[model samples]
Target chain A: MNGKEFWIYLAILAGSTYLIRAIPFAAVQKKISNVYVRSFLYYIPYTVLSAMTFPAALYATGNVVSAAAGLGVGMVFAVMKKGLTVVALISCVTVFVTDLILKQGI
Target chain B: MKQFLRGVRNGVPIGLGYLSVSFTFGIMAVSAGFSWWQAVLISMTTLTSAGQLAGINIMTVPGQYAEMLISQLTINIRYSFMSVSLSQLTTAEFKGIKRWLLGFFMTDEIFAVAACQREVSTKFFAGLAVMPYIGWTLGTLAGSLLGNVLPESVMNALCIAIYGMFVAIVAPDAKESRSLLAVVAVSVGLSCLFYYTPILKELSSGLAISVCAVVAALLGAFLFPVKEEASHER
Candidate 1:
């Protein structure tokens, strides 16, 4: 798209995104006392993060075997309390190395 | 100065993480026939992964406004949950424009940073949001402009950036909470089931991931409940 069209598209996107984010704030500007809603909100982050991260990490490889290898190593490091950088590096390395070793019949 | 530096420090890893993933988005946009500026503009405005990806899909299938809206809403519907959770954390005095503005930039990383803070000041959260916001937008712009010059191999590798960011977010928390161990376990297990099971493998990647995550977390919470002390603050 040209510059004018690009700006227009950006405007549309920015407007929509802002609206999606703004609606929740608008709704809950007042205190929400519902026990069930509060409890549900409490677990939202873990659920959201888990949903967002797990599948990609496990199925990084199209096949289950490779994916399991990567996820297995990742979970081990994650359980060990390795920080983000380390867990990521270890997972990627594990996937890469496993693929390499399996390829080489080692 | 201290607070500003803290924001920057908190943002560095997020910034670094965004650089690679946003760069990939940049490349994807351009390769899909969008101009560099068009790609950059999307990044600048949306500053979201699912939104931007949906944008690309819309661009490819122009004239499908309804379809685009549905796709975008489905992907971003989760943000509402994040917003609700964060709304509770904000002080009563933080109502009005400030809350609205800060709420705009509430991505997962930004939320994690804010949630983990000892004091969730509006100013500090805004500062933190600003750092990553600027980094992500600029990174996308730069990547779009430069993607043509980069090799396919390098771009492929950069595809892993989002995974890196997830690692960073979960790693620190997993260290603090023994309960999180089950969270990780269930997620991996469910993810494996989805991938390996023939019937379920037909599901879309995004939906599959979302289902696995939510179910696994719920199950994990039940099986290995967080002790009262840790649950108190969380």
Candidate 2:
């Protein structure tokens, strides 16, 4: 917590983080050719995205109801292939309004 | 140059999302007693939400170097998997120094975008990474300097936008492929299971996410292996 400790801590954290990220690239120098390995890598994105999204999305906002509404709206737009910004804004607005409505009813 | 511009354009929303989230982080950092420069520096160096927050928590407690190291290692090790996966898609010439530089900005958003591409160009990845990086740093600076200027209502609402964007990224693919749908379901199911189950609920978020993703992805690979022609298909 002093200036010196802060810098040192940040360095360690950053250094480790950088190493963790960069090591994989250094190790996996060439493109993978194995069928199963290739398939696993290809599926990584979607699965990671899914794992990060659900339940978290429903709890991201202040209330479950508003977050769910926002998620539904966001998914609708996303499925329709709306732009990222559009989906983001609309979903936020949906949550905002839903929260407002829920607040007033209470 | 064109690819770079396209990356920046695609990065616009991610930058916006980072601006708000890091702004929140900045407020938290300031409250946690970090000076403006320190808060900005942390954001610049770490570029990860969970790791930096946990780091800040550890910093407050003091003398928990081991704890801090373990926290960061566990929280961020997923990036290694992402980088390895991305390396397979990147050009063979994208090695040495270029790989190190690219690795710096391989945040989840950037990786998601870059990995979706047919060809991962260094130029495009650079452009994609820069916007969010600047947004993250500047947002931290603004938050630390300005404090909580935004209305509470707005900030609360904005919390879900980034998640919305994530849904936006994956929904299309899940719709197109049954295998992808199965993977999504499995991941969500496992995540929920981890979250709700009494004992498993104690598991760290990083580990839970990694387990869910890896397990679901392996199942997907086995159940629905990409055809030779469609292996590289986005």
Candidate 3:
């Protein structure tokens, strides 16, 4: 919304995020006994990253084609276990090149 | 001093990683109508890419405070688990304001690095957290400010960097673990379903993502459970 609302929303988000991490650090003294919970937590990072990546990445570029190209190059780099910065730079550059090509119609 | 320096050194790569992603976030934030200062402030306050993006998405629609809270809570809930896991590794003597401060800065990258250690010190963790914090905030500042001057085409393409970062994070794990591969496929498939299906597509992106991630993760846990491993420090 407005300026006030934005700050308030940020505050709510920051406070909630703070509580999420702080409560565990403040309260959880021992390793979790629950294997199910541990396993679930273990998988959260991978699944969440994947969920965020797929469709969202497709839409991030100017068009789906360029985005797909970027994604392809990115996946290739990632599967090869390239560093994060290298993968990101190559993907973005690929998207830029693909976008230019698609626009020029050459 | 050495421990803190080691933490700082270890955090350098993470900080560099954050720089690129938060730069993309900066552009997203400005495009969504937030000022550069506001974008940087959000990064400074939250230090969470997913939660901040979700919050920004909620902001775009307006009048969805409850949705904002739920989205942030769900997206950030993983950090709670990470904190719990890291707590087991932290020194028992660490507590009070220091604990709170470190906890606030315990982001995904920080936790991943810190957790790998046999033991963690407050100084080391602080050093580890500060570099990334500065990197994230500065990157947002650079993005929000520089993004305004950049051409539309360049900015659009640059946005792919964030996505690339996410893929880089997950692809290695998926390649190594069949269970993680399944989890990635399930999450991606569910996300696509949510995006394409008429009724499911009605859900906000934040909610859709959380649902996909949670469901896929639960299924993965059931199908391929992680065997318990002995801890070096605990």
In angstroms, the error of model 1 at A25 is 3.2
TM-score result, candidate 2: 0.96
The order by descending lDDT is 2, 3, 1
Candidate 1 lDDT score relative to the true structure: 0.65
Top candidate, metric DockQ: 2
lDDT tens digits, residue span B1-234, model 3: 998898898777677667767988998999999888889989998898878988888988777889888888867776776676677667866777788878999886787667657778898898888778888998899999987566778777777876776777778767877777888899999999999999999876756776887899789778887766633421
Per-residue error for A2 in candidate 3, Å, reads 8.2
Question: Can you write out model 3's per-residue Cα lDDT over A1-106, one digit (the tens) per residue?
Answer: 4787887788898999999889888887666667776677667766766787888889877599999999899989999989566887889899999988888999
Span of ten consecutive residues with least summed lDDT in model 3 chain A: A29-38
The C-alpha lDDT values of all candidates are: 0.65, 0.86, 0.80
Better of 1 and 2 by DockQ: 2
Strongest candidate by lDDT: 2
What lDDT score goes with residue B34 in model 1? 89
Q: Fraction of reference contacts reproduced per prediction?
A: 0.32, 0.77, 0.79
